[model samples]
Target: MTLPGLDLPALQPWFTAAVPGSGELRAELVHGGRSNLTYRLTDGTDTWVLRRPPLGALNPSAHDMGREYRVVAALAGTDVPVAPAVARCDDPAVLGVPFTVVGWVDGRVVRTADELDTLSAAEVQRCAFGLVEVLGRLHAVDPAAIGLADYGRAQGYLGRQIRRWNDQWARIATRDLPDIDTLHARLARTCPPEAGASIVHGDFRIDNTILDPADPGIVRALVDWEMATLGDPLADLGLHLAYADPAFDPVLGGKAAATSPRMPGREALARHYATATGRDPDALVEGLAFYVGLGYFKAAVIAEGIHARHVRGESVGRGYELVGGAVAPLAAAGIAALDGSG
Candidate 1:
């Protein structure tokens, strides 16, 4: 099917001109993601996935499509189940912004347990274990080997990130949400020690992956590299725990489905990651809190940004209202977790 909201006639010549072994590029929208634009492009005999920064995005460092391409390309021959990268176009003249193309991988991205209930228990375990193991491997990789040694600030990553998002909230603050600022201040004061620099998937949740049903737990392709970065590895683990934890507020935007209720939970996932990476989870709690709070704080800012975009007549839909509402509570939860209440 032809992709919606894309001008194929305008994009075709560019694809043919830059990428080889392609003819008659076709497009299709991949749904349910808000940060970046994703599309499946095919050329009758060849297929690829394209990702680019959102239209009119103000966060230049936040959405570096070229970095996504370079990082995924560097991991091409590794055991990580990343989609094979084809090419990247950094020139603004092509497709309005920088974009990268990777060969499409096949799998299902399950967001609810009903989807998993159909599968056998063993299969479910495989998917869960695979997710944990892959994360451990990701954390173990040396950034210098992949030409990403300078991906982020070499020191005080946590401190810099905390201040960055807090400033973002300050800039866009139109209402009196004391919780956001309170959390920021507390986290800044209790900033955890640097937990050794390594590659961290800023947002490492199950929804960002594609799982093969036949293999159940094994990820066929890990998607969404827009938030990938070089930072404290425990930060990635904490973000995973934040999303995997069973304590999220109920009624998640009328999705009305429990996606991770029985999937070994966050503690078990952490142990699995620890065992795989030979790291001690007990020693990483402080760092984890810092990262987890950062993750939630970042999520709130992103939701606010989306709300702002919606008010300006963007492509966002009403379903995002619930996402916007999650900001305050999630920020509060992060603070509590940092305060040793969670």
Candidate 2:
């Protein structure tokens, strides 16, 4: 009848208007995404995934359903498998927020290290290599070719990210950490030129993808495109490799795992990507550090923003406390990445 996040009576009309015969459906929140709120909708015969920004103040640039919908829709005939974009409702009057409806993909999203253990070691290894290959594939796609030429500026990606996240930290900070500032300055100073530009997934991780249940190696859909943009491909690579850091575990809790026990080392993943794309990984060493540091800082800022909302009684869910705890560890980890110690 009613869901806390999904206002059914309000949305039914929009669904009827956009999806035809989809006004009557059951909706449930799909948990685990730390940023956007995702819901699964089914009308007993058809299913769709709906995404909207979390309720509370949000960074407009970081959480945009239109961008997510557009990117996925553009990539429909692409090697990067994504849930088919079904409809988009820009009028907030229908659901109290802009939302995107996409075809629901039936698959498993392994979100933690323990979830990776359920499969055999070989399966886990397949999952790891498969993720790497898919990322390579995504980076190989051209923004201009896909009509995404204006997704973002092509050059100065690494410098802009370092400055952007540092600026974001200033906006939603709970407290000041010297290490974060140090990392920001160091990263800014050592920022390298863009090696090349492509449509970056912005946030690429094992959990961000849906694997075919029957074949764990197959990436059925790459979900969560809220951060997709045109930028240096290595920026995405650095962020991807940063998750292999054990420090990220605190953010996801110990359940719904994505980390792999048999994951190839970060260097190995980078090398494989370089070979696959013919982009030398050596040229990116310094920029990788910058991007990785920027990743940690961005994660910390996001956590801090969520924590700030929770503190202001504006958050929904049970895990805001744990998220706040991660801000410190992530900042410390960012320092390590910047200092070349981690």
Which candidate gets the maximum TM-score versus the true structure? 2
Best of the candidates, lDDT: 2
lDDT of 2 at 212: 91
- Quantify how close model 2 is to the true structure by its C-alpha RMSD in Å: 1.7
What are the lDDT figures for the candidates, one per model?
Answer: 0.72, 0.81
Q: List runs of model 2 lying over 4 Å from the truth.
A: 281-287
The number of clashing residue pairs in each candidate reads: 3, 7
* Model 1 TM-score (2 dp): 0.90
Clashing pairs in 2: 110-257, 111-256, 111-257, 111-258, 112-256, 112-257, 112-258
Q: Over the stretch 1-342, how does candidate 2's per-residue lDDT look in tens digits?
A: 667567988888888889987648888888777778888899889999988888777764768889999999999898989999999988978877889999989899888677787888778777877887898899888888989989888787777787788888888888877877877787788777786888889888889999999888899999999988888887788888877876666566654344454677877777777777777677555457777777777777777888787787775556666677777888888888877886
User: 206, model 1: CA deviation in Å?
Assistant: 0.7
How many backbone collisions does model 1 have? 3
